[model samples]
Each structure stands twice: as structure tokens, then as C-alpha cells.
Target: MNNLTPERRKGRKYDQVLEGARQAFLQDGFDGAGVDDIARNAGVSKATLYSYFPDKRLLFIEIARLECKRQGDEAKSIMPQNLPVRDMLSFIATRMVSFFNSSLSLSIFRLCVAEAERFPDLAQEFYRNGPLMAQTKLGAYLREATERGELNVEHPEFAANQFAELCKAGIFARLAFGVDKRISPQESSFVAAEAVEMFLARYGVTQD
Candidate 1:
């Protein structure tokens, strides 16, 4: 899904470089993707490519950041401010699970895991733009829910992180290892339901 608007992603040559880099990284993996190949595929001069991204790692990191931000934006757009706590949590969890289960997301995650030790900064950049941003946004939502007396969360940040983890529960490891990466709607529903239940059990307030 092309989440980026053409107007916002203007500049024909700039877009070409990013598109070329994305294809190269996805097809060849980080280690195998070359700047020269990216330039050739992009149909841009080496100078043009370098003008946008100083190094290959920077290019790859930017791509990862863009994709992660896109996913987050999509998820955020659907987060309802008026929904009940359980319903909102369920919605967020389901959206996150869908994003995480995608082939593109899985590929980027695998690359981050494999290269994190050598390129810690790149991994940090990925985390900041992806999971960390999600957690922060979710924390704000949880805080709002608490203010509305829907939940008993004392630490919204911690609760947010835990909810996201609960959503990933039995699926992330399988995805990382390339085992049963595909998730059916039924499976996603099950995970989202369980995650919401567990999260509400911990933080939801009940009227006696």
C-alpha cells in the first residue's frame, strides 16, 4: 500500500533514488545491495544518489524509517478517541498485529536483528521510528483512558509497552525465525482478543 502522498514525496529524481534503494534492499538484502547498483537501477547519476543519501547504510536506514512511520501513521489514523477502553485496545492491537505480520515488516525486522550488533545506531533508528513511537503514542492514549476513569494505569508508558508485547505474544518469534510467518484473520483476531483481555485485566477499572 502506497501510504505516502505523491505531493509530499515530490521530486522525481529523489523519489527514484528511494524507490531504487527500497527494491535493492528488499531484493538483495543490506549486505548485498550496492550503491552502484542502486544508481543504475534508479536511472540516476551516482552524484545524484549521493546527494540524497551520503552512504548506503543511511539510505537503508531512511527506508526502514519511512516504512515504519507509514505503518504507524496508518494505525494512528484509526485509533478512536471515543471508544471504550477494551474496544480501543483491541483496535490498536489488531492493527499492530497486521502491520507486524506483513512480509515487508518481517524482512526489515530480520535485517535489523541480523545487523544490530554491527550497526547498533541503525537498529536504534529503526526502533525509534517504529516500536518506540508506537509505544509513546499508545501511552498517550492509555493516559487519556486513565483520565476518563476507564483504566487504572499508574504507568501509561509501561502499560503501553506491555500491551504491544501481549499482542506479539506467540507470533513474533515465529516470524523472526521464518516459521509460520503468515497470520490468518482468525489468528490475528485471537491474538488481539487475548491481548486486550490481558491488558484490561491488568489496568481496567470495574464498577462495583
Candidate 2:
């Protein structure tokens, strides 16, 4: 379980600690980041940092949660709802692929998996905030589109998961496994386009 409580989060240095810890984790990974370095980066003393986060794992989990929330909020704010189904799906696929290909996202995923056994809640929190959140949002849109006669999806949640996997088809595995250091724009675009097409082929409404 996470050690961070609502009361602890109310501390003035909470955000500062989190930001500093995020940088350290990004640079040195979970095991490599030290409490002293994190405190120094945040311009706070070790005691101040420890007061907010009793365990380093709790700090990492909180960072992941907040980052996921930020990304999810940004996606919701900018995603256009008035576009045609194909266009909307294309937009979603592109965004998903880009996020999946990012170094920070990959690192978070790797860390979650690596710590799953010892810290199962960490992986659960990541899933709830990341993949499950995306799926739920996409499912709602798909359901609305289906009601508007723009799509034929019977199971929007399942379809959303499928489309997400399709968007990850080529670049995700390669990057996650170190087969590729970076995903070129062309590769990401191609994957997104293909995912949109394949998804539309299955669920798009036919017009005579």
C-alpha cells in the first residue's frame, strides 16, 4: 500500500518533492535515485522529504499517479469531439502511439513491471491511471458514436482496448524491448494510420 496520505499531500513541499524525485528517477531510475539527491534537487532537507513520503516506493507511485493524471487531463482538454469518426480515431491513435513511444512512459512501464511482485499496488495504480483510463474514455466516445450511427461497435470497451493494441503493434514492442532507441515520426504516423484504418474496417458504419 502507498504510504502517502491526503494529509501528507497537503504539505507545502509536496509538489517540490515530487518534481525533484521525478527528475532523479528519470535520470537514475528507481533503485539508482537516492533520498539525499532527491532532497538536494528539491532544495529541501531529507527530514522534510521523509515527512511527506515515508518510503521511496510511495514517492515513485505518487509521481506516477500525478503524471498520469496530468496527461489524461491534457488529452481530454485538447481532444476534439466534433470531428468525424475516422478523424477522431486517427487523432486518438496518433496520441496513443506518441505517448507509448516516449522515454518517460517506457521507463514508468518498465519500473512498474519490475516492482510488481514486491509492490503490486504500484502496478495496479499505474494501470488504473494509464491504460484503463484511456480505455474508459475511448469506450465512452465509441458508445456515443455508435448511438449516432457513426460506428457499429457492440463492445466499446473491448474495441477500445483492441484499437489501443493496434496502435502499439509495431513500435511499442521494439522500443520496449530495446530493439529501437527511438520511434521515428514516419513510423509512428504509419502505425497510427494503419490502426485507424484497421479499426474502422471492423466497426465503421457502411454507407451505400
Candidate No. with top TM-score:
2
Top candidate (lDDT) = 2
lDDT of 2 by residue, 10-103 (tens): 5778889989998887666566688998998899999999989988877877777777778777867887869999899999999999888876
- Give the poorly placed runs of model 1, Cα more than 4 Å off: 1-62, 72-78
Model 1 lDDT per residue over 1-208, tens place: 1321112333669888988888877666565678888998899989889877777766776688677667667756756667777777878898788867766677678768877886665567668768898899999988988898888999999988899899898988886676874778898889989999998888889878
What's the C-alpha lDDT at position 110 in model 1? 76
> Relative to the true structure, how large is the alpha-carbon lDDT of every model?
0.78, 0.85
How far out, in Å, is residue 125 in model 1?
1.7
Worst lDDT 10-window in candidate 2:
1-10
- Cα RMSD of all models vs. native, in order, equals 6.6, 3.5
